[model samples]
Structure formats: C-alpha cells, structure tokens
Target: MKKILVTGSAGFIGFHLTKALLERGDTVIGYDNINDYYDVNLKYGRLNELGIKKDKVKEHQLASSELYPNFRFVKADLCDREYLNQLFKENKFDYVINLAAQAGVRYSVENPQAYLDANVQGFLNILEACRHYPVKHLVYASSSSVYGSNTQMPFSVHHHTDHPLSLYAATKKSNEMMAHTYSHLFNIATTGIRFFTVYGSWGRPDMALFLFAEAIRKGEKIKVFNHGEMERDFTYVGDIVNGVMAALDKPATSNKEFDTNIPDAGSSNAPYRLYNIGNNQPVKLMDYIEALEKAMGKKAKKEFLPMQPGDVQKTYADVKDLINDFNYHPNTPLEKGIGKFVEWFIAYKDSKLK
Candidate 1:
C-alpha cells in the first residue's frame, strides 16, 4: 500500500478523498489544523464520523487503529515549517495532496491576512517540504474563480488566467504559478485542479448550497445574489474526488517538445499540468434553487439582492482536457445530487438534535 499524506483531511473534499483512499487500501496520514473558520463542532462532527476523537488530535500527533489500520490523523498546521519538515522526514509519503486553504472570496476580503498566512505562506512550506523529501505527485486545489472577468463561455485550462477578481482567486492562481516554479526547478510532478462550484453531502457551510439549504429549512429568507441570474458549474463532490484520484495516479511529465514562443497555460516544459474539474454543465442559480426546493419539499423565501463584492456573475468549466487526459467525466445530475444532499442534511440534523 502506498503511503499518502492528505492535508486538510477534516475538510469536505479532504474527508471524502481520505475515505476513498482508505477504502482502496492505501495508507493515509491525514493532517489538519481544525481551525474555527466555520463551526468547530461541525469539523469535530466530521472527524467523529471518521472515528477520530478530539483528544487524539494534537500538534503533529498521529493516531491509528486496527479497524482502519492504514488510517492516521495528525493535528498540525501547514504553516509551521519545522513541524511540516518533521512530518515529511518521518512519513516519507509516496504522494502528497494539499487541499487545505483559506476558502471563500468574500471572507478573503475581510481577512486578507488569513489568506496570506494559510494560502501563500502555508503553501510555500508544503512546497519546501516536498522539495526536501520528494513525493511522487503533488495535487493541489485551484479555483474556477481564477477565470475572473473572462467572457469565455467555458473556462479552459489552456486559456490565460491573468485576471482574478478576488483575493481568494488571486491566491489560487499564485499557487499554480508557485507549483510551476517548483516543477521547473526541482522536477516535482505537480497538478493543479481548477475546481468549479462543488456541492453535496458534508459540504462546507459557507458554500451557497449548504447555506441556502440550512436557511431555507429554517424558514429564513435566502439571499439571491445578482438577482438570482448567476450561473455555476455546480459539480458533485464525488465526481471531484474521482478527478483528483485520477490526477494523483497519473503523475505529470514534462512536455519535451513544448513550444516556448507560444506557451500553453495548462502545460509546460516542466513536470507540471493544470485541468478544470467541473460538471461542464452550467446551471442557472434559480434552477439550482428549484432543485433544492424539490429536495426539501418547500420553497425558499427569496430576498433578491445585487451581486455581493468579490462574487462572480457566472462560472462555467471547460473539462475537455480533463476528459482527454484521464477519461474523467462528471455524471451526477443536479436533481439526483441535491436529493442525496437533502437526505444527508436531514439525517445530520436529526443526529445533531439527538
């Protein structure tokens, strides 16, 4: 079994990916700071479902069990250079997946320093550790927000991503650049995934789907930004996990015949690559709300409002490259995915009440 290190293992994507890796018989060392970016209880609740107790988590502490013999958890901050170095030295992971970051565009506007500390400096520390102790592949999360104000119908990895509308988008784009530099200088196999609007069970509360679901269920008015005209490539979480696993399994190789004169943003002469992992099916915001309403068996109290600062009008992903490279295709329909999410939401709420 390959030993893999997954940062942010308590986060939504990380949690699902870790479960997948564990089920595939891989030895996974999970790391997370478990910061109170949202609800601390919710984070702990996720860990509890995974059989990890609060007391077991400590700075650099490792926990394993016979039931999930290959699974382990470490409570460590990625920004801590010494601790991260120690983790690299001890674990010697075959692959490293960095999914931890300060998420949310509007949140970045209010807490710019948090983004600098976690997304920039923290990512630098991960890259440095990888440089010192080489891993087979490094897969990190990028965002569709990197497309910024582009008028393109579907955002493609080959297209130039020079404009970022928000601090969160800027940090993600910066991560791709940093990864390219590392791949160029150190020959590290790095792949950056520009994820669209991912949603499903165990999703972050800050995300639109989860927030709207909770508010609507509570009989509260749901904010409809941009007068509910926004469009999003609302991808299912399971599909995203498949894309990430595919990228991790296939390490990027340098394009020997890459033309320097007319360079492509998605590929390089170095061991680096980028792809957009989305459903490739953009849905109108109102349509998405309608799906949620069907799942909830109730209509949301709508409060139409102008677009919030740092929010985009629409996002669509061009996943042709992802399909060509990995045969990856997202198959979940909005109605089906929303139905599953609603089921989980009800169960989770009941469990919380108990």
Candidate 2:
C-alpha cells in the first residue's frame, strides 16, 4: 500500500481519485483549502462523502475519515509554503498528485492575481516540498486550454503551446515549464497530464454541464457561448482518474532518444513527461446539449451568445502518448457519461433541498 498526498482532494476529480486510491488500499492524505471559488456547500458535500464531516475539518489539522481507514484530510491553502513543508516533512509520501489550482478561464480574466497566487506560487511550494522530501513520483494537473489559438484538429503534446489566449491557459503552460525545470534540476520524476473538458457527478457549477443542467431544471436559458460553435473532448472524470493512476504507477524517465537539436515538447532528457488524458472524441456543443437534454428529460433553452473573452473555440486532445505509454484509453461514451451526471445531479439537488 503506497502512501500518497493528493492536493485539491475536495475538488471534483480530486475527490474521485482519493476514493479510488483509498479503495485500492493506498494510504492517502487529502489536502484542500476548500476555497469559495464556487459553492462551499458542494465542497463540503464531497468531503462528507469521504467520511469527513464539515465540522471536523479545521485549518492545517488532519481529519481522519470514518468510512475509509486509509484516508485522512487536511484543510489548508497551497500558498502556505511553511505548512506544506511541515506536512511533507511529517509524512514520507510515496507519491504526490498536485491538482489544487484556481480553475476557470473566464474567471482568470477578472482576477489574474488568483491564478498567479495559487497556480504559480502554490505550485512552486509543491515543487520545493518534492525537492526536499523526494517522492517516488510527482503528478500534477495541466489543462487542454494550453492549446490556445492552435486550430489543430487533434491537439498533441508535441504541438506548440507558446500562444496561450487566456491568463488561465498561460498559467497552466507556466506549470508545465516549472515542472520541467524541477525535473531537470532536481531529478524529480514529474509528469503533467493535460486534461480535456472533464465532466461528471459533482462537477464544478461554473462548467458548462452543470450550468446547463441547472438552467434546464429552472426552465431558464443556458448561455451557449460562441453561438454553439464550440467543440470539446468531453472526457469523463472516471476516465481521468484512471489515467492519473496509470501515470502515477509509471514514473517518468529520461528520454535517451531526445535530441536537443529538435527537442520533443512531450518528453525531455530530464525525468519529465507530458500526456493528454482526453476522450479523443471531439463532441459538438449542440450535440453535447442534446445528450444532456435526453438524460434530463427536458430540452434546454439556450441563449446563443458571442464568444466570451478568454474562451477557446474548441479543444481536441490526442491521447496517442497516453495509449502508447500507459496502454490506457479513455473510452467512456459521451451519452453514458452525461446520463450518469444527470442522475447524480438530480439526486444531489434533491438531497440539498431536503
């Protein structure tokens, strides 16, 4: 049983990953600030599912899960370097998965400082801790948004991502660079997974799936950005978690074939690598909505709007590296994924009402 530290353990993907690890007999320390980026109640609800009561969680204090003996949770901010160092020094973790970040592209437009604080400074703290503590593997979350302004059909890790359209994308790109630096200098086996549009049960309210679901429930108009001209590789959260586990099991190694003359963007001579964890199936925005409508038993009233600032037109992830390296393929059908999400959403909403 490996001892792992999962930052952003209260978030959507983080929560699912933590549960999976615990079920697999891994000792996990779930850490999160439980920030009010969205509804705190939803975060608390997720924590509750992990046998961590909302009242039991205190800042920097570890709360043991009642349901899973292998799981423990700590409420803390990623920006707190001193606390992070303390936590790392206390626990000799086998692996560390850094998923905590100030998410959302458009939100970054209004508050760029948040991204810098959490994504930039917060990530530096994780790197420092890993450098000092020396973990077996360090896996962190990157996003498909990094492939900004690149009209490539299937976005590959080899593609040039120097042109980020939004602050969020820029910060995510900076994360990959920062991670590569640590891997090069400290020999930290770091792997960055660029996630596509992940959606499922307990998803972020700010995301399209959740927004559309809520609007449809209220008989309100859901804002269709880019006038429904958008497309996304809508990967399920379950698939993402499985991909992360696969990557974590296989630590990155130096690429002997890496030629400095034409350096590959995906892998380096240093112990650093990048992979895209997406469905590889780009679903149209309108089609995605239709699937959701079928699941919810109600059609959404969409408010067709111009493309918002800091938003990309489309995202399609090329998972060739993921398939070749890990032999893992994310094949969860969009309709099935959306159906599961709707079921969970309705149940969760009803629970909240009671």
Off by over 4 Å in 2: none
| Model 2 lDDT per residue over 1-354, tens place | 999999999999999999999999999999999999999999999999999999999999999998999999999999999999999999989999999999999999999999999999999999999999999999999999999899977999998899998999999999999999999999999999999999999999999999999999999999998999988899999999999999999999999999999999999999999999999989999999999999999989989999999888888889999999999999999999999999999999998889
- Clash statistics: count for each candidate: 0, 0
The lowest-lDDT stretch of 10 consecutive residues in candidate 1 is 58-67
The residue-by-residue lDDT of candidate 1 on 1-354, one tens digit each, is: 789999999999998899888889999989899998998777777777677887777777797643477898988888899989998998799999999998999998899999988999999999999999999999999999999989888889989989898999999999999999999999999999999999999999999899899998899999999999999999999999999999999999987778999998999999999999999999999999999999999999999999988888888899998889898898899999999999999898888889
Query: RMSD, each candidate, Å?
Result: 1.0, 0.6
List residue ranges in candidate 1 displaced over 4 A.
Answer: 65-67
Candidate lDDT (C-alpha), each: 0.91, 0.96
Q: By TM-score, who's the top model here?
A: 2
Summing lDDT over every window of 10 consecutive residues in candidate 2, give the lowest-scoring window.
309-318
lDDT of 1 at 239: 94
Provide the lDDT at 352 for model 2: 84
